[model samples]
Target: MADITAAMVKDLREKSGAGMMDCKKALNETAGDMDAAMDWLRTKGLAAAAKKSSRTAAEGLVGVAVSGTKGAAVEVNSETDFVAKNDQFQQFVRDVTQVALDGAGDVDAIKAATLPNGKTAEDTLTTNVATIGENQSIRRVKRLEVSQGAVVAYVHNQQSAGLGKIGVLVALESAASNDALQALGKQLAMHIAAAFPMALNEEDLDADLIERERAIAAEKAGESGKPADIVAKMVDGAIAKYRKEHALVSQLFVMDGKTKISDVVAKAGKDAGAEIKLVDYVRFQLGEGIEKEASDFAAEVAAASGVPQQPAPVN
Candidate 1:
């Protein structure tokens, strides 16, 4: 069995929001497996379903750029947040995003593309890491384009012009006026930032994700002690609700909290004197889905002071 360290227990506590002793016990039961420990806590009703184990340890900027009907967004992750604030790091992100505009959102292509400084983007990133004293990478790039109409960009918690923690792009296909399209796009982009929709429509959602949610709902419904038919109905209802809540068009608009996003887009199009179709959208939240290494502060201090580290006391 894997030894359960105090840091592992602490990480489980943070992920499950359970007591320290409970977290330690759960980790032991799961053989020091973090994912299994979280599941054990949830099964025992000691943790909330919304609790997530993913850590946002990587820090950097999400840079966005819009030119005419095309827009691009790039995420550059650094080992530390302090580097995110560095002018050189920020400039690298900005330039990489601009490179992505022509790279068609391909990370490899963007890396090979030329920068204004006459060096390959990948070479510049390596140079930045050496000078900035931290590891960094161009994590992701996404571009949106429309044959007609405008692609609007928005940055939430803006760190600078076109750079922020959350970057969003909304693509509208329409013959509408640019000003009207941009206004509607900005509103939709802001909604995407807040709502965190999984997909543009129900059909667009991941099949695997939907199946997993269905399995969980079915298990929960089965525990209700209802008839098999009733349990089936309950599971279906839960899945339908999940789809409505997660799909962008079916989700309620954040602005009004009552109108569906599909209806909001229809009304905006009518007001703009043209028909607008929300063709696509992208929302990039930094460090999402990345599991960072848990920091061992006690060990760090012990090493710094040249003293042996002590194990945490178990209650």
Candidate 2:
């Protein structure tokens, strides 16, 4: 049997908000598997099913640029947050996003596009790195536009024009008035920034994520000891709830918290005197899910100078 340590129990309890003894028992029952232990605790009604949402581990910057019918967003990643704050680097990202808007949303196209100083985007980035003295890369870019409707952009923390840490783009395809659609689009972009919906709809959600959610829901439903029909119904209800929570169009608007987003769009169409459809949205939160190695500059200098380092003190 695997050893169930006190630290493991404590971690589980912290994640689930379960009693320490209950967490320990769950860990023991699951043979020290953290995920299984979480499930065990949930089955025993000691932990909530939503506890797993905290495990996301990614990181990078998100930026958006909008021009008329076209808008583009890009995520540029550096090793540290200090690098993200460099004025030169921020300007670089802002410029690159404009390039992305012009380059058919293709990374390579943006890289090869010419900068104002007669150098390509890639060359400019290299030159900037030499001057700025930090490692940086363009991670990803996405573009959205509508032939008939307005594309609106929002920046969560505005550092300058067309630059911020978290950026969002909302595209509405409609025959609606430009003014009306622009207002609605901006509101929707703000909603996207605040809500962080996983996808445009349930269909666009990640397959692996859907499966993982289903597995967790199934495990939780199985403990009801209901008949097969009832258990299946419970699983379906759980999935529907998850979809409503994660999907953009189906989610309740965070603003009013009463109307669904789909209903909001429908009403906006009426207000605009034409049909308006939410085509797409992109939201980028800075430094999400990126594990960065901590740097110790003094230790690095000492190592270079041939000095020994002291070990960390034990707790």
Query: Which candidate number maximizes lDDT?
Result: 1
lDDT tens digits, residues 1-315, model 2? 889876687778877999999988888888899888887776667887642442323333566888888899988877666777787787778788878887547778778888666888889889877987777788778999788788899998776677767789999998888899889988898888888898998899888877777787787788788898898899889888988888999988989998889999999999878989998998877666453444678789889999988876789
lDDT of 2: 0.80
- TM value for model 1: 0.91
Q: How well does candidate 1 score on lDDT at residue 132?
A: 91
Best by TM-score: 1
Q: Cα RMSD for candidate 1? A: 2.4
Q: Which ranges of candidate 1 are over 4 A from the true structure?
A: 1-6, 18-33, 36-55, 310-315
Query: Model 1, 1-315: lDDT tens per residue?
Result: 789987788888887789999999898899988877876776567887542512455688899999989999998998878988999999999999998886556999998999999999999999998999999999999999999998999999899999998999999999999999988999999999998898999999899878877777777788889999999999999889989998999999999899999999999899988899999998988887777776678889999999998767779
TM-score of each: 0.91, 0.82
lDDT of each: 0.88, 0.80
Worst 10 residues of 2 by lDDT: 51-60
